[model samples]
Target: MVFIRATQSSSDIACIAVAPLSIQPFGVEPTDFDAFWTQQKQTLAQIPINPRLTLLNTLPSGAKVFLLELDNIDNRKVYAYLSVPAGTGPFPAVISLPAFGDAPVQPEPLIMTDFAERCNSINLYISAHNAPPNLPDPNAYKPDDLSKKDGFYARTMIMAGIRAIDYLSTRPDFNGSLGVSGMSQGGGWTIQLAGLDKRISAAMPINPAFCEQDGWRFERASGFPNYVLVGRNLNVDSNKTLTNMRYYDAVHFMKRYRGALMFQVGYEDDVTPAATQLAAYNKYRGNSTLLTMRERGHTYPFDEYFLGRYAFFEQHLIGFKNPFNFKAKFLADAGNDRTVKDTAVLEPQFLVNNEKNKVSNIQWAKIEGTGNVGFQTENGKTVARFSQKGKYLLRVSADFDYKLADPSVASYYTLTDFVTLDVGESSNIDVCDSDKEAPNFSNCPQNIALTTMGTSALANWTPPTVADNCGTPSVSSNFLPSQSFPIGATKVIYRATDSKQNTAECSFSVIVTKGDSSTPPSKNDLAISLTSVVTTPRPHSFTTFKVKINNKSARTFTDIKIQIPFPSGIVTGGAATSTLGEWKEWCSNNDQCFTWLIPQLLKNDEAIL
Candidate 1:
């Protein structure tokens, strides 16, 4: 049923709306953004985890520190300081990133060994650069071709961080859980590593750098490594450099993350500004906490606020809890009020502040007016059936159970939220009364225009992920990927429908155009390839054709149309399945003839099917 919270007197109840702060993103991301990073990780995976560790020293708290090195992408090396607890135990791991431009040898007393000892976990304090600590070389990354995406220095640093995580996971003493943290440049790395790598279940990025690198487009201050002046060093085209830097922008990454994030931003800090980091926090749908220290600027918070990070990690990584105050709250939201028929389907959510803590069980009870109310779990949701048509108040409670290191210590919390349901006589609107919210669609593809290779271009895109408060939503699309889009503009609509029949839709346009052949395709503009495979049998033979179209022209091509003859074996007048183009048969000199329509494709997209 729809949840309606009971209210008090008119004088007591007040509603206020405040506009949220957001850092609007600018610039362009490559069409192959996700694919590019996936390829980089794959490249890293191909290289072996040639790890070497040397004992450095041991703290009084029985924490041993060691110097570690590992092989990264392209046979490059990554250096770090590894710290572990004294026990012969398998512990959760954390890979700490370093500050920008300054590669110090010691990652210790700062946050490495201290964190390991406090949480009793393994700590791999790593450097962002290829060279070892204490040796700060500006040219460690060979930042000459910084104007290009693939050749950017930030990409290399991220790859090195990936290698560090790879090395830590291989240790026998390392537990399955892993995390990342950093300050300034390292803070930016922390967010990037956590967002880029799913292995990191928890992250603490403090005054992070490299976020919203292009915020200067609107004359606004950006996070660390502000690319405004950095662009001059590029000494290249400003537009091209802006496009290239988008790949390294931290804001783009956090938008897709949903894990536990311990993010901090400074109010007065000139680098990694408060607005930028808060913008990142707002974009992420996760268990996250943002601490905006008033006087803090590009540095660690005071001991009181700083110590909370350790407690946060302890609760998340080590399953230990002193206080469950890490900015997030244990919540049990019963949702809005509803008037339904006899059966009421309720989808109550149970969320915990720390990952280590578990939601043991959820109990639904009728606290007020009710007549023989029965409860049952259907498809993982609580359903209530009332015998009589009356108003009933329900309290759905969830327990946040903590797993303690010491069994003797007691740790647990219960959170409950209320919802009211009105039961009417049996009717067809049973599902409607229970659900009133529509599914939300995210990651919807941006509108794209494509240059037609033949009659049509095979346009493909990753479907958007949906979220609904009710239940698992089923998605439908107007266009099937198997079919081809003909010339001109085609709107691809994707719809998501929940179990209750509530629906939502999102769409993007695919425009196709024929280009002018008079002006030859630039060297970096177009790439088109075609391949055919055939099979012959005693009775019949079949040929399969595949064509790939890529548009990196940075501008649309218009004017000329090109078409390859449709395959001949199919039944005429029926349908000849071509994944890449439309089949329009014409009455020509022969039995039949067909030509594919060409259209203008987008600047940076490619299509295979």
Candidate 2:
């Protein structure tokens, strides 16, 4: 619950923490924590793993790559990219977890080619969610609701990690030196897996999220998936939510973890704040080392620090000598210029002093802005100009090629510089006047210019900031009419968000007169009834359904579409008939479903399918 901020003499060096590590546990350890997990594992053990492996031959690497899939709890499947070094004997194994977003997991051969070849081990990069890796939308597998105790998202994700280990144990080349590594949510999973599975030998979690759930209560930033605390404007039962969260808290797991742990923490990380990480680190009872970076935030430095992690695994898992001697310094050309105009040019420089290391690649040199600011090389040095006015952080990372004994590993390091661009002040906007008896919805004004003084002035408004049943109002520089609103006074909220993520919001009321307009109809005014009556009682028998759609509203409905989902076992022979509508049947993942579309339904009209 205590924080100490340590100032650094150089911007390259992060501000370190002066506070002593304290074991300030947040949530109470559930009384049935052990029993609950035991039951979970036993339940998972009962399911048959209809495992499947497909070799990927296009990506040529030192190791053989295969796409592996196995069934987990909840009928969800685990998809991972497995890489095994070409060898018959057993090898050390490592499981890499993913971060906390919808970011795609690159193909195994493309991402882990270097690490697998260097470690000469089996690497399994599993999807954080139930869906396949590199999915266009990773949130597709996200649970519908997290408040439910029995089927929480984190529980399934944690079990996937455990089940991944179970799958690894069954492999013929399993050497048993299992280690888990990941950043953010992945880091939290590493802790959860290492604690739950005794077979795990080591774990390295970087800026792990989902720890210290009570930090926000003490006025500190909470970790990712900040579930315990309700939203800024939300109503929920906090006591019940907190009770369910304690079951999966990483700090509680850290207390029971018995594996070798190398935890990396960023002193300036707002996502997984240092205070929260320390809370878990201080309580760890196993052999552990805390690697602290002063200048880093939510991201890993990826330089010598990351190399140290690889070395940790190499030493413990494969008996390789630790290549711990590596150093690099990041320099900025702006010097002490903390604030600059958006037109100013900034160039970053890298200083590598270690003789044993070589900069193999310059990954990127870019600024963190709302939009892309094009980069160009000037004077043989990488330079970027700020396009939009806002605060920006210029980040640079490079891969350092080095060797430790027989294995050659590439260590990536990153350096960042913070700067603010003055784009000028945001302009306040006034709501345009509308007639009280205007037919249909009034057109919210458009092209309301923002301050042009800065680099770029862009405007956006929060959706549903003001609730009007006339569909959500749309706003850009100008307001546009959405759906027709009922005759009433409704407030519309608008805001301008700058490149720096700064915002200015304003609200105005629009009064609609009750001249010729009736009250807006609710979306739930339509009623649907589907009754399935079996024509034959035996298996593979024909089934008939009585479907009815009734418009229980005074307003006419247009473009009415209804989708009916059926179980996988149901074999759709085809739609029998439809009255005043068109019906179509489709199959998704071999599951039959039906959709009906009605062009228009008059008030109080009914249609049967």
Best by lDDT: 1
TM-score list, all predictions: 0.52, 0.51
Give the range of the ten consecutive residues with the poorest summed lDDT in model 1. 1-10
Q: Model 2, residue 393: displacement in angstroms?
A: 44
Instruction: Residues 129-211, candidate 1: write the lDDT tens digits.
Output: 76667567666657636567787777778988888888777778877787778888888888788778888888888888878
Please list the C-alpha lDDT of all candidates, in the order they appear. Answer: 0.66, 0.61
lDDT per residue for candidate 2 within 147-246, as digits (tens), equals 5555567888888888888888998877787878888988998888888889888888899987887655656656766766542223446666667777
**CA RMSD per model (angstroms):** 23.5, 21.1
Candidate 1 global Cα RMSD: 23.5
Report the number of the highest-TM-score candidate.
1
